[model samples]
Target: MLAVLQVILLVLDIVWWLVIVSAILSWLFAFNVVNARNPVVDSIGNFLYRATEPLYRPIRRVLPDLGGIDLSPLVVLLLIFFIQQVIVLYLIPAVYRAGV
Candidate 1:
């Protein structure tokens, strides 16, 4: 059970990084800092979009339009942090201390 919790935590950490990368990549593409037409760039952008958009889509719906700014990734990162804190600070200790 503890091992499973640790694996979940690791995945969350990875996804948090993914969200950050996706947001930054979008900004780069928008600002023309990177060539959107490049095969490498397009492939990476597509991968990130596919991975993160499912999670971001619902958050985007709940959030109001902010013109060009997107806050969904930040919100998702915060939620991930909160979940990590809950598992590490509460769930893991409780389970271990309880001899489970």
Candidate 2:
């Protein structure tokens, strides 16, 4: 059980980090802070989009737009938090403290 919680926490941590990185990269890409001509950088951007888009799409549809600035990621983050902190933690109370 301890190991399972650790693994879930580790996964959640990874997903959370990916969300941050994806957000930054997305901003940089959107605002042209980073050069997109580099194949590797472009690929990274593409990969991030692929990974994050599914989570964002439904939220995007439901949430009102912020003057064209999407707030779906915020919604998605909230959902993720609920899943990790509420759902997972509640489901595995014994493991939650150990994981944290």
Best candidate, TM-score-wise?
A: 1
- lDDT for 15 in candidate 2 is 76
Per-residue lDDT tens digits for candidate 2, residues 1-100, read 7567668778877777778889999888889999989899999988888988888888878887679687776777776787788646575775566664
Model 1: colliding residue pairs: none
The TM-scores, one per candidate, come to: 0.96, 0.78
* lDDT of every model, 2 decimals: 0.95, 0.78
Worst 10 residues of 1 by lDDT: 91-100
Candidate 2 lDDT trough over 10 residues, lowest sum? 86-95
What digit string (tens of lDDT, one per residue) describes model 1 on residues 1-100? Answer: 7988999999999999999999999989889999999999999999999999999999999999999888999999999999999999999999899887
> What stretches of model 2 exceed 4 Å from their correct place?
87-89, 94-100
Evaluate model 1: give its lDDT.
Answer: 0.95
lDDT at 40, model 1? 98
Candidate 1 deviant stretches above 4 angstroms: none
